[model samples]
Target: MKSKFFIKGVISILLIFLSMYLIDVFVTIPNNVSIKVNEIKYSFKGKIIEKFAVRNTEPTHLKVLIKYDSIITISPNPDLVDVAAVGDSLYKPANENYIFLSSNGNIKKFFYTKLSYETRSNKNFPREWRNKWLDSSMWDSSKEIN
Candidate 1:
């Protein structure tokens, strides 16, 4: 009798944990990222003076140092790190969550909302979209607005 109860308890606990994991992966994280995308809007426009990776961090943080009106740093997506080159123009509008990169007269726009939605729907979206999002070959200056 005692063994039966113990087995049931363990099964119940396992089911609870599985449900929690499902909710976290499917709902919680995605909603949080979407909220952050809508809430946090940083405005900066400048030339990328430097790009470096902080190797000391757990997942090495890639950073872009910009200068124009004042100095500021941006930790963009890993894909952006490669697309953006030193001397390229970087613009983040105050009203939106778009990161625009203009390189040699060609421009690429990265929308945080789309990234968040992609992350919510597919776990491998980032890796799959890597190099595709900001590839220099796909850059178009006229199509992208400042």
Candidate 2:
């Protein structure tokens, strides 16, 4: 009887640890929201951006500028893309300022804005700029704002 009780206690401890680990893995940190805008349907590739988390407890702020031209069309709409608007925003642009939130709710992912502008230019921009814009810390992989 004594041995049985000890075994049961050990098993219970193991179960508790397992449960905690699972919770940590499944629980989302509520970092940031991501949205993707695709002009072509069913295309896996499209413009994306991640926005920082916006909650009563924590707020993320962003300011962006996009150069406009006769050939440009900002898709999705920056005004509509805000944590205040719908917790997250995503859109596709024919030609416009692309904005979105970062996944970690951090400002690092803001590089997407630079990327959009670089794409507009015929001249090749520095590789470092692209790297800076695409860096995971700078931007979220899951978020996409066209």
Candidate 3:
């Protein structure tokens, strides 16, 4: 009876460890990547000096080098990258989730929605995608981060 109980306890411990490892691999890592990318904030106005693609990443990102030597990585969506020129002026307001690009008096707004979608669809991403709950107005109440 004692040996049987000991074996049962060992099996339970192994099962618990396996479950934790699976959760960390499938749930934690993917959500962390999405959260980290969304946390990047921008508040500046400058002209784009150069543009290039960042390879080796799970999802290819476009690196936009702007005036004052500032670089920002954005999603490589054609609507955002194809329309932007080297000399275009880029404006991203403080505390906002989008940027405005102007070229030859034509202005276009590029939101981070594509970034969210790409990250969620990456091969390393999990089947269960997490929502951005913090963006809700309920989280922005005065009782919160005022």
Candidate 4:
């Protein structure tokens, strides 16, 4: 009778540990992505798991299910741009920022209109705005722009 009770206790303990391990595995969070523009840095945190649902195709583009506060923008390696609003997928850029989507369902290149001298002359221009403009200029020069 004592032996039976000991065996049952051991089994119960094992089961408890196994349950905890499984929960940890399933609930693990993904690494966050941080982007800094000028002096301001923004961070987006959540899980981005890639599971093979279909046997043939490549992971159906990794599912980036994120739970973030405010607006979150994700730029995946190579060129996958996703914008999330209130923890939900809002927009996925068909092309990069420089390549705008036209009403005709075609991609169009956007030329950078020169910034006026007055605008650049603003001594109190916010650092964030300046950084955004610089990033835009860099993107325009890159091959991925179009």
Judging by TM-score against the true structure, name the best candidate: 3
Tens digits of per-residue lDDT, candidate 1, 1-146, equal: 99999999999999999999998877675535444443335577778777776675433223344553566666665566767777888777764546788898899886523333333234433333333333322333333211
Q: Which whole-number lDDT from 0 to 100 does residue 1 have in model 2?
A: 100
TM-score of 4: 0.24
Q: Model 4, 96-140: lDDT tens per residue?
A: 223221223434333222222233233433333443344334333
Report the backbone clash tally of model 1: 0
TM-score of each: 0.46, 0.28, 0.51, 0.24
What are the runs in model 3 whose C-alpha is more than 4 Å off?
Answer: 1-29, 33-40, 56-61, 65-67, 76-78, 115-146
Alpha-carbon RMSD to native, per candidate: 9.2, 14.3, 9.4, 19.3
Query: How many clashes (backbone N, Cα, C below 3 Å) per candidate?
Result: 0, 15, 0, 0
For candidate 2, lDDT tens digit of each residue in 24-136?
Answer: 56663222111221221111112233333345633243222222211222333223333322222333233222333433354221222323432322123333333333432
Candidate 1 has its poorest 10 consecutive residues by lDDT at 137-146
Ranking, lDDT, top scorer first: 3, 1, 4, 2
Order of quality (TM-score): 3, 1, 2, 4
Which structure is stronger by lDDT: 3 or 4?
Answer: 3
- Superposed model 1: Cα runs more than 4 Å off: 1-39, 56-69, 112-146
What's model 4's lDDT at 91?
26
Judged by TM-score relative to the true structure, which candidate is superior, 1 or 4? 1
